[model samples]
Target: MDIETWMRGYETAWRSNDGDDIGTLFTDDAEYFTEPWTPPWRGRDEIVRRWVERADAPGDWTFSWHVVGVDAGTATAFVQGETCYAELATTYSNLWVIRFADGGRAASFTEWWMDQAHASDGDGDGEELG
Candidate 1:
């Protein structure tokens, strides 16, 4: 599967938070790691369940991403992204490592994210108070 198309589907699934939509992104035995060190949500069923449990409300966040690199031989792609949470006035920088299966579905996915520090002035501008 094309990496860009898969990423777009991921964004769609993120916004919708629908079980079916989320299910389509992974294989039956997919492993999803929310953080590099944390335990993964194994299998599509678990991933769907856990995802819905922590589902983000629609319109509450905006995300932008770009593919950083790809190893076609390994079926892996590296992605960088930024997520802005409107209500919290916070943003996070994310790096995702995705390994795709034979088809478009992901066989394994891992994410590393860090919250961007902002000034305390409550301006929501995402600027550091240097």
Candidate 2:
């Protein structure tokens, strides 16, 4: 599948928190890495379960992303999302690498994410961290 189609399905699944939706994004024996060095959630079932474990309930966050590049079977993208809870909000910056299988499902996927800077750091104004 093209990157746009695949990415739209991905975001839809994430926002819906549907197991079937999540499972459909991967191959039967897919691997998902939360970080480069961390052990992956191997296989579609495990990937779905682990992903659900970390899910944010529907309507909790908003995400926007753009494809960075695609080559052969692999594609990379940058995603930005903001989540709000208890009157506090946090923004996240994320990078994802996805290896698509022949059928358009992911054979392997990896993500790297970090929380964006807040407006204040306990003082009066927010300062860049050097």
Candidate 3:
């Protein structure tokens, strides 16, 4: 499946915050790693549950992404998101590596992200510190 098409479904799932919607993005035994070294949410059930537990409420965030590369069954992407909570707001960038199985679902997915420093008034966008 085309990466962008898959990502649109993912974005919709994120917006919906529905376990069933999220589950459709992965295989039965999919593995989702929040970070390169973090323990993964193993299986579709765990992935859906964990995502629901941590997801932003509907209409609380905006996401923009573009596929960086795709090779065989593996794909990579960069995503930027801004979350607006009642008392806190933040923006960050994420890099994802996903491996697709026979179907459009992902078998293994990994991500790396870092919070951008808060931008001061009139300071333009925040700088990313390594």
Candidate 4:
């Protein structure tokens, strides 16, 4: 699967949090790492379970991403994304490394995320700047 198409599907899965939609993105033996250092959710079943457990509510957030690089030989793609949580007034930057198996399903996926510091007015109180 092409990076763009796969990413679109991922966005759909993220919004829907449907097990079947999530399952379509990964291989049977796929591994998903929520953070670089954390142990991955191994296999499609576990991945689906974990994803649903931590699913983001629809309309609470918005995300945009772009492919940074791709290595065709290894079927790997690097992507960068930004997520804004409208209700929480928070934003996060994300980096994902994906290794695609045959048929375009991800064999392995790892993500690194950093919360963006909210802009504050001069006041010491934690009020976010609009």
RMSD of each: 5.2, 4.9, 5.1, 5.0
Candidate 3: tens digits of C-alpha lDDT, residues 1-130: 5677778889889889888889999999999999999899999999999999898777776667777667763444444444334335666667788888776888888887755553344446654333
TM-score of 1: 0.89
Clashes of each: 0, 0, 0, 0
lDDT of each: 0.92, 0.77, 0.77, 0.94
**Order of all candidates by lDDT, from best down to worst?**
4, 1, 2, 3
The TM-score values for the models, in the order shown, are 0.89, 0.79, 0.79, 0.89
Give candidate 2's TM-score: 0.79
Residue 127, candidate 2: C-alpha displacement in angstroms: 13
Judged by whole-model lDDT over C-alpha atoms, candidate 3 comes out at 0.77
lDDT of 1 by residue, 1-130 (tens): 5998898888899899999999999999999999989999999999999999999999999999998999999999999999999899999999999999998899999999888774345578755566
The candidate maximizing lDDT is 4
Query: Which pairs clash in model 4?
Result: none
The clash number for model 1 is: 0
